[model samples]
Target: MYNKTIITIIRGALGMTDCKRLMEERRSVNFFDAAQPLTPELLRQIVELASLAPSAFNLQPWRLIAVRSPEGRERLWRLAQQQPKVLEAPVTLIVVGDRGAWQGDNPAWGELAAMLGGAEAVKPYLAMAEALYGATTERRIKFAESNAALLAMSVVYAARCFGVEGHFMSGIDFAGIKQAFALDEDEEVVMLLALGYAEGGKVLYPRRKRQSYDELVEEV
Candidate 1:
């Protein structure tokens, strides 16, 4: 298990106000300043921060294809229903989820073993992951997509922390993306994230109304 004290300390440094502001300010930017491309170093930093997102058995199943090159972006734009944001954003990430990440060969298994004491300590976890995520083809896909979605949300928030904006787009050519990107059979495309500086550092429209907490929550 993770150290609660350490987690609390990190949260304290982040502060509740900062967290609230990030949640409130983040928007799906439709217009990106194409002239201001994301630097490789900045992109790396954002991804590294996003990777801290939690996952089942810590078997980080996510993969990303950063489409920054002109050719890559153009190809992705075509595969993504030609969304203008795909071409306008400085970088677009093809988020993929590996359904086979629960396998024993995954490096996360070894890392978890080391954290828990020894390789023997990971046996139960391995069995649990297999039983939960490997039951059927649909289950495997669910495991991958669910975990990748968490990482995708983290990427959006992490980018916002650095003054970068992001948009999550599911309108895509799934089969074409898989074929064009040459993904493995077990790798499922989760979504695409377009990231860049928003045009004029603002959104064209005001924030839309969201469901109230009372309307969304349920007491069971």
Candidate 2:
């Protein structure tokens, strides 16, 4: 019976059903049930999935400073152009970009690379990575900020899959937030996300359709 069950699992492995139905159901939920609070484990799970997003030269540059304190939330609300959601949401994350994560040889990358390939095999790649990404300060900051935005989107998508409503907010004073959090001046503020359960049925504005694939995409 165990062997049969294993066979059944293997048979379905390659053709496993997609979660696209859930994806289609997900929308930007502006209204949140503030009473239905999210737990740390759930937040960690969502972040874990988000952290899997792609980055240039494999430099994971995103940082999430989650705010839960009442005082802090109030301050955030004021900074967020006085948005009520900042105070009402169960969890608010301050997404930051670590602009210097890859400029130097990051220990995390070194360890992972060494584990996958030998240390000698990894040195040249690191050298090339540093030269390309670390050649100038501007290049580094741009790539890091870009990566942060991508990761932030991944977090929203991941939270949606986790059955949590995620709202991307850019209504805050970036400099004030950095100062409040004591973040490095050079670190870029990508955006913020409020995660919680959906409240009353959200009334969404009509979404603008995208350009046709042929119009947007060019075949080489």
Q: Please report, in order, the local distance difference test score of every candidate based on alpha carbons.
A: 0.92, 0.79
Q: What is the TM-score of each candidate against the true structure?
A: 0.92, 0.82
Stretches off by above 4 angstroms in model 2 are 1-18, 116-120
Which segments of candidate 1 are over 4 A away from where they belong? Answer: 1-14, 201-203
lDDT of 2 by residue, 1-220 (tens): 1233333343333323446655566676778887888899999999999999998667787688999778988888888898777788888999899777875456667775666576675676677767766678887777677889998889888988788888888877988888878888568777888888888776876655769999999999
CA lDDT of 11 in candidate 1?
A: 38
Query: Which is the leading candidate under TM-score?
Result: 1
Worst 10 residues of 2 by lDDT: 1-10
lDDT of 2 at 156: 85
Assess candidate 2 and give its lDDT. 0.79
Tell me the tens digit of each residue's lDDT in model 1 across 68-165.
99999999999999999999999999999999999999999988888878999889889989999988998899999999999999999999999999
